[model samples]
Target: MTRSTGVVVIGGGQSGLAAGYHLRRSGIEHVILDAQTAPGGAWQHTWESLRLFSPAAYSSLPGRFMPAQDGQVYPDAAHAVSYLADYEKRYELPVQRGVRVSAVRRDGGHLRVETDSGDWRARAVISATGTWTRPFLPAVPGRRDFRGRQLHTVQYVSPAEFVGRRVIVVGGGNSGAQIAADLAHAGTDLTWVTQRPPRYLPDDIDGRALFDAATARRKALDAGSTDTGGVAHLGDIVAVPPVRAARDAGLLHAKPMFTRLTPTGAEWADGTTVEVDAVMWCTGFRPALAHLAALRLRGARGHIATVGTRAVDEPRLHLLGYGDWTGPASATLIGVGRPARDAAREIAGLLGS
Candidate 1:
């Protein structure tokens, strides 16, 4: 028999959990379906030493605060996973683990969500899968010819795995920089390849004061002002400035643009080459919404078109955790809760709750 619910959340990560928490508080019945066996999505897959650059005060779910004192650094990947597990148990959120949602289609008035277990029907659906559903590797020449074990950062777990090997970390994003620095300290010969110059910011820039400044600048820019470009260009919000410090220490080498991958290593656009034993692609991630083939997507990007905050074409569907609405804040743990709450309120109104 097909199961039915008032709402079905597609992911069980921070955003999804927050959505579920809010919905439950508002007396909305829903079930969360996650592809992973556990609650934390990308966090469970992150490297061992990864910690939230945002303090614990900002990196928290809806009801419960992160278990840390004031001004304490947020937990690492494992600690985050444990905290999420505890949150699930504490709230008694109904989550179907290991049930990979393969397809979602509109069936009459309700939506049909097909997973490995069975099909589910829901009156409303919130796609909280976030932006990291799929690792996006750049289409470079000779990628297949690379005989080294090339893996995306999502599959990376620890630098100890690359102890004595020559490792090449690709991309200049937070993940690439952090991985390069971690492996460098682990006695691994490391090289970081990026197409653009790296940008950095201090670890605790004025102690959460930067957030208010950034938010204000972001608002002013939204109101059509160009005076905030300097603050806006201060690198990604999730980025930790210490990565550049590692580069200054001569532990990381930022190379030119990527050209091709070879059996021995990688070749750059400047005719330079590095013979590395392993390659970790920290390029970034993209939304994995291919299963929603029935929905009218905004072309190949798979993003739903929106006017203001409401979805233009599909009013019943909603997108949370997208950077477009909330800026860089939407994608971070600190930024997801507000959007999730807004989405829940919108969904509730649609359901006549």
Candidate 2:
């Protein structure tokens, strides 16, 4: 079956929801296509111990503020899930769950979104399928030869199974630091590994500050100014409560990334080695854009070149919430709103709605 809509939103997660909210506000008829059977997007898949970098109030979508979590300075994964699920219901966004988009192709003057359930003919398509599905694990020589258990951030639920195991956590990003802290708190024999020394944001700095800085940078760039002081001058990881506590306790120290993996452990270039029972890869993810492959929009940098949120090659398509390329910090709950609103406005303008 084929359905028609003014706009088609792929992925009903935070980015998709943000776009939906703005599109709805703009009086655009749209359908949100979500591969998941439920709401909450990537938040639902994160580990149980995961916490937001800021308070619930700061980490929210466009129209509504997330309610504070009881006695928690930073909300947990469950709280985020609850908020996202409720947001979908409260907004009455036209979300079709369990509908996985396979490919999108040009259909005359419209875009044809192919899915397992059906196809959609949309005047404009917003690809908001964020990076969660494409968890990245770097290829190190002898990685395949490792006999111990290996897991990615996406597959991890909690530290229950790994409580007593000797684990090596790799990656220098927030996920790596956060997961390492979770394992350390669980009393696991943990070895945190990074390509370089981990850089942490100030204790007072959080998502809000980062977003503000990004906004300033965007404004500066818009004004044709070169001095855009942004997050680049700051640290990589946010010092959330848990991460801060872990760092204070001297538990989150990281080792240099190993040169290769052996049968039972990792080996460093300096001939140092650690025998670990498991390897936890918190590397990160690339944008989940395989569905748009048929459109052939990806460029040499492995991303579709864009002017703001709209694809340069295909103005009929907009990419949301992938990262800074779409908008300044558009991956975050609060950050995605601006780009989403702008995208909706552009679509409405194009459609003469």
Candidate 3:
């Protein structure tokens, strides 16, 4: 039996929850299908000590404000997960967890979504799975032969696991910098290897303001306008404070890009070698669009093409939390809500509500 809904949301994370909330507010019937056992998407699987670099004020969803003390740093991953759970309950969003969507295709004039549990037919669908679906580990030679435990930053939970081991963290992004600092303080012998030294940002700019200038610049770029020569033209895309702290703490090393992994350790492009007990790859993630193979995606760099936020080919298909449409803010908690609300309004109009 095919379970039918007015609209089917593909993810139950912040974006999906926001979409569901907006749809419900408009009195539209919809159901959210998520692969996880509960809400909070990737937050549920993030490292134990991870915290938002943005303040609580910037981390809110559509209708709720993040509960936090004044001047306090952003919520950690656990706190974020708890907040998302509460958001779901408060809005009474219709979500079906543990239903991994395997495929999505257009059936006649409607959308057909096939999942592990069953099939759902709906008038529209929103892909809010976020950008971190697949961890992108570079194809370094000899990685299979590495004897030490090599893991992605996604699998890292606590520094205690590497307390007595020599750990090498690869990458210069926020994750790499933060993990290096944590492990170094945890008494683990650590080395942070990065090809490009990151441009760090101050934890608090003037008057304790979180640095959101990057997001604004990205939005301008996406809108086909060049950045004005101002504060935005100051530095690299990665923030500066964490990187500076990591370097000051003796955790960062400007190494060549990873060339390969040997049974003993890793080799860099510059032929330098580092022997260690573990390797933590903090490399970024790629969009998981394998399930959308049936949809003819027309975009550069393997992304689905959109004309001003709506899919060019699929009318009812819209992308949320994608940096392509709304800019870098699309990926952050603070940035996703407004676009999600806009998408919900568009979806409601399409449903003739």
Candidate 4:
């Protein structure tokens, strides 16, 4: 049976939840289809020690604040998972877990949302499948031939797996820096690699500052002023306590990108080879938009042409939480709400019309 809905939201992650929050408030008939069997979305898949650099109060969705537990100021992955689950219950959101959306196509005036379980015809569709499931591994020469283990950030769980082993952590983003620190603390011999110089936010600043700076930069750009007064880039590392400790121990340093991979490990441009047991590729992720390939909305670099969060080529669709390109820092816990709420309001208006 093709169920008819006002809006069909894909992915029940933070972004999707935020969309649902606004949709419910707007009295729109919507259902969120999540691929995961549980409520936590990608947070449940994050590494054991992963945490939000912001305080609990700042890391909230649209309507509810993320409550701190046991005097914990900054929430961890588990807290985020539980909070999201509770948020859904609190809002009475219509989220259907374990229903992986297969594709979204035009059904006359509505969208035919094809999934494994059933089909939904929605007036508008919100794609909020975050980057966690689509970790990117840079194609280095000889990487395929490397005999040692090569794992992407998606596969990374804990540093205990690399204990007593030589490991190379690639990329200078938050994931690479955090993984490097965790592995070092676990007694793993590690080398850090980055495409360029690593940028770090000041110790006092956190995700809140990052969001504020990004918002200012976005506003300036909109006003034809790209001069964003030395604000920290969103990708820059936040000095969380553990990361600070690693910086103090001199383990937070990164070298230039290696040239290629060897059977044992990686080779540098100068022919210096480091034999390592594993390579942790923290390069980052692309949006999980494979299902939407049929829409033909994506442009170069696999990004869809978006005006705000709405896809330009397909006006009925909105892509949320991919990154700043979709909406300023929309992939973060606090950031997702902005784009999601905007998209929800837009969807509601569209459905009403």
Candidate 5:
């Protein structure tokens, strides 16, 4: 059976929630399809120690502010999940959970959303399925032959399992720093490997500051003014309390990237080898857009070209929460609002509503 709506939102994560909020405020009827059985989206899958760089009050969606926790300066994964679940109910957004989208194909004047549950026809579609499900691991030789356990950020729950074992955590981003810290705190014999020296933001700076910078850059771009540098110049790795303490204690010293993996461990180009019991890849993730493959919209970079959130090839389709390409810092909880609002407005206009 084919049902109809003004819009269909894919993936009910933070981005999807923001899009839903704006679409509701615009008085546009839409339904959000989420693969997760419950609320919280990717937060549900994050490691127990994962903490947002900002406080609850600083990270929020379009209509509601995430309420601050009783004692946490920076909310943990659970708090984020709770906030999203409540936000969905508070707005009474029409979100259909446990519905996995299979494909999105053009169907005359509307787009057809094919899912395991059924099909829906909509004048527009918003893809907000974020990157959690698509954890990325670089192709290092001998990875498959490694005798030790390998894990990615998406699969990692805690450092408990790696305690008392030799482990190498790869990647230079926030995840790598945090996980390396977590392991060190747990007394794991750990080596942090990175492609280059890790860059840490000023101790006082946080996600809010980054978002503000991104906002300034976006505004400057809209005005056709000089590039404001945005968050690019600010540095990587936010020094949250844990990461800061870990680094201060010399527990987070990083090793240069290894040339390849050995059956027992990693080997550098200089022939130095370190044997380890496990390797943790905190590399990152690609956008979860496999369901859109049938549309044939991906460019050479494996991304759909976009002007703001609207896809250049198909204006009826807008992507949210992927990253800067969709909107500056749009992947962050607080930064997605502007792009979501713009996408909703553009979608409404396209629908002539």
Candidate 6:
């Protein structure tokens, strides 16, 4: 069965919710298709020990603020999940849970979204599927031969599992620093392997600074200027209390990425080897656009060709929360709001015209 709507939002995560907020304001008839049985998108799956690098205020949706509970400086994963779940209910967003979208194809003038349960037909489609399920691991020599357990950042839960075990955490992003800190605090042996030293913001600042800087950059770019400078490199590690404490204890140092993985551990480029029981890959993620493969809009970089969130090849389509490629900081909770809002406006305009 196919139901018609003004727009069909793919993924009911932060970005999808943000889009829904604006689309509802515009009185656009839209349906949000989510694969998860629950409301919190990726937040529900994050590890127990995981907390936002910033405070609750810095990480929030569009209309409502994530209230700080128990004066917790940074909200934990459960806190975030609860907030997201409540936000959906409070907004009365039209979300269909456990509806896995298998593919989306252009049917002449409209788009048809194929799902496990049913199909969705809409005048416009906004693909908000984030990168949580598509964790990326770099190809290394002898990676398949490594016998030690290899896990992505998504599979990681807590430091308790690594206690008394030597583990190598790879990646220079916030996840690598945060996870390594968690394990080190628990007395677990950890080796931080990164392509370069991880950069950290001042202990005083958090994601707010990055958000402001990105806003400024977007304004500047829109005004046809290239000079967008304030807080540079927003994706760098934020010196949250835990990470700061880890740095003070001299546990945040990083080694150059190893050349290859051995059965027992990893081998460095300079003839050095480190034996580890597990390799935690905190590398990164690619775009979760597999369902859109049938549309043939993806480019060589595994990203859809988007003309500022709108698919360049498909006029009735837009993608949100992919990464900087879609918009500056589009993957962040607060950051996705602007892109989502703009996408909604564009979709409304197209459906009206």
- Runs in model 5 with CA error above 4 Å? 222-226
**Backbone steric clashes in candidate 3, count:** 6
| Clash pairs for candidate 4 | none
Can you write out model 5's per-residue Cα lDDT over 1-353, one digit (the tens) per residue? 89999999998999999999999999999999999999999999989898899988789888789999888889999999999999999999899999999999999999999999999999999999999989888889999999999999988899888878999999888999999999999999999999889999999999999999998898899899999999877888999999999999988889899999999999999999999999999999999999999999998888699999999999999999998889988999999999999999999899895
C-alpha RMSD by candidate, in order: 3.0, 1.2, 3.1, 1.6, 1.2, 1.5
TM-score of each: 0.88, 0.97, 0.89, 0.96, 0.98, 0.96
Q: Candidates' lDDT values, in order?
A: 0.75, 0.92, 0.76, 0.86, 0.93, 0.87
lDDT of 4 at 298: 69
lDDT of 3 at 208: 21
Q: How would you encode candidate 2's per-residue C-alpha lDDT over 1-353 as one tens digit per residue?
A: 89899999999999999999999999999999999998899999899889898888999999899999999988999999999999999999999999999999999999999999989999999999999999888888989999999999999988899977999999888899999999998899999999889999989999999999898888888889995768866888998888888999998888898999999999999999999999999998999999989999888877789989999999999999998889998999879999999999999998994
Q: What digit string (tens of lDDT, one per residue) describes model 6 on residues 303-327? A: 6677778999998999999876687
lDDT of 4 by residue, 107-203 (tens): 8988899999989998889999988888888779989889989899889899877878999999887888888888878878989999888888778
Of candidates 6 and 5, the better by lDDT: 5
Q: What lDDT would candidate 4 get against the real structure? A: 0.86
Q: What TM-score does candidate 5 reach?
A: 0.98
Ranking by lDDT: 5, 2, 6, 4, 3, 1
- Candidate 6 all-Cα RMSD: 1.5
Clashing pairs in 3: 200-239, 200-240, 200-241, 201-239, 201-240, 201-241
Tens-place lDDT digits, model 3, residues 1-353:
68998888889998788778788888888999899997788999988767676667668887898788344465678778888999999999999999899989999888999998889999988887876678888887898899989899789998988978998888877788778777876878887778676656554442123225545565576678987432334433233344455667776655656678889987776788888999899988887667778887856667677654467789788777766353345667776776777787888789884
Alpha carbon lDDT of residue 237, candidate 3?
27
Best by lDDT: 5
